[model samples]
Target: MTVLGIETTTDVCGVALNRNGVQLDSIVKNEKHIHAAQLVPMIENLLSRNQLKVFELDGIAVSIGPGSFTGLRIGLSVAKGLAYSSHLPLAAVSTLQSLAYPVWKTIPATESIILSVTEIQRDEFAYALFRAIDFIENHVPDFHLITKNEKETVEKIFENPLHHFLLCGFQAEKFYSMFCSENRNVSFAGKEFNACSATSIASLGERYLERNVIADVSSLEPVYGKNFIAKKSNLFSRITQ
Candidate 1:
């Protein structure tokens, strides 16, 4: 099956084509604030280069995130539009799951844990934990928001000494240091696995397609992980007073 994947859950904006769970090609840009302007064009370019039309693809996959609010919205908007126009099925893949997928593939150990961490805002992070055995299983199925010093919750998850632990995703290095110690069996994933990738999204997208897991395009929304509270501007407050 051929699937088109869109990823805009972080600073990275990417589009990829996957056939039978293998990435055929991908185009990615790692510049902040460019997703709105560049996402659709990147998709067009990727499809054109592959000599494929939107209708010809089996399905569309998009990162439904607990990452950048704006980026997630842009990506889902485009994916939903395409799904609506082309009458294609949509798969909403977790942003954190996609981040950990590559690392999961590389680990040879029978039992391991992957902690996927990404910055949601300044000094705040969103994380998801997965247990990798024969396949990656979501231990903490939902993304949880946490502050820098909030290591107790995460600590409890990986407290078991039998399993190897891996820290990955956008702000993985910071968390690795926070979690790593002489007594813990822990390691940091390579820098390449730290960023979200369209290839991983597409690969997981294909699996979802095979399992008949399609999203309801009309009601789908990004998982922001935290409530958005717009602080009142000082000018507005003064005027009101």
Candidate 2:
């Protein structure tokens, strides 16, 4: 299974090529606030380094975001174009879940619950709490791997206390604070794995693909989260009240 993965949810834009659930080559450029101009070329170079072409990929994975709105769009555009042109299956991975990789890796398989956080600026950040399931090897749709965003994200974390919970992402530092008081079972990632990367997305994407969980790219879209509905802070307005 040859899979190509892309991640551009924050200041980082990354591309990774994977063969049978293993990483072959990856390129990530830290443009911070400059994802638009840097993403394509980085991908081209990455593909070249790996000696591959767009059409050669069996499947393409994209980080469908809960990060920067424009950043997410740029990645989706690129992903859609590649999938359209090459006739490859589009696997839209969750940005919040990609951030959870470090949390998953640092801890063992025993840790079932994870509260992944990414800073979204203006006082709100992207968050997702995943309660890991039994490793059942099945192949379905990628989107199905993630339960849709329910209102009880925070509550879910508090309800089932696992061995430990991993929290890390672009805004992990800032976001971790929001749930610190509420969930006593939480554990955080240190500086090394703090940021988002395509490698992690690819790894998780590979896992999803193996499980037969996949989603059609045509119906795939970026998620900006419920926080972006209004311009100002939904969190701040509530806090001041």
Candidate 3:
């Protein structure tokens, strides 16, 4: 089976092609907020270089959300459009889950936690904790939107000190100091393995396809972790006071 995977959850915009769950070719560009314009052409280039057509793709997989709000929309819109137009199935992978899969595949089935932390705002992060049980199944008990409050995070880390923790994702390095300061049991995944990979998305997508866990292209929505809270105006207060 042939599949295309798209990832646009962070600074990176990546597209990958997989055949039988192995990566064929991938294009990853870490440009600043350029996913809106760069994704389609990158996918096109990957297919053209491989001498393949969009119709030849069996399915499309996309990182649905919990990263950049705009990035998620751009990726899902493209995936939905492709799936709808080509009459192919769609797999919606969570941005955090896609990222954690790679790490989960590498680690042994020991008692441990895999933290996928992506930058949401300056000094703020969106993190998901995956409890790795085995190569095939890791459970994500919770994911949260948190700030740079070291105290609360440190407490959470120590809640289960016996379980080894592995950290990975965008801007994961920023948490190194905080996590490492008190708990040596937790470690960061190297820079090479941190960023989310479309390859992982493809692999996960292939599994989703096998189990008939496809998405409804007509009504699929990006999983924005939280609602966008617009900054309220102080003009009314000033006028009244």
Give me the candidate number with maximum TM-score. Answer: 1
Task: Report every candidate's CA lDDT.
Answer: 0.80, 0.67, 0.77
lDDT of 1 by residue, 59-92 (tens): 9999988888788877888888788778899988
For model 3, how does the per-residue alpha-carbon lDDT over 1-241 read when each residue is reduced to its tens digit? 8989998888889999999878899999988889867787788788889988888889998888677878777788778878877789998887787877888888877777787877777877777778777433432235777777755765576576577888888778886665555676778877876787888888888878776778998888877777853222221121112
**Candidate 1 Cα deviation (angstroms), residue 48:** 0.8
Better-scoring candidate (lDDT), 2 or 3: 3
Cα-based lDDT at residue 12, candidate 2: 87
lDDT of 2 by residue, 92-183 (tens): 78887777666666555564666666665566665666655532221121221122233355545466554466666665665565545456
Total backbone clashes of model 3?
Answer: 0
Q: Which regions of candidate 1 fall more than 4 Å away from where they truly are?
A: 134-140, 181-183, 228-241
Mark the 10 consecutive residues where model 1 has the least summed lDDT: 232-241
Residue ranges of candidate 2 with Cα displaced over 4 Å: 134-163, 181-184, 226-241
Q: How well does candidate 1 score on lDDT at residue 30?
A: 95
Cα deviation of 185 in candidate 3 (Å)?
2.2
Q: On TM-score, who's better, 1 or 3? A: 1
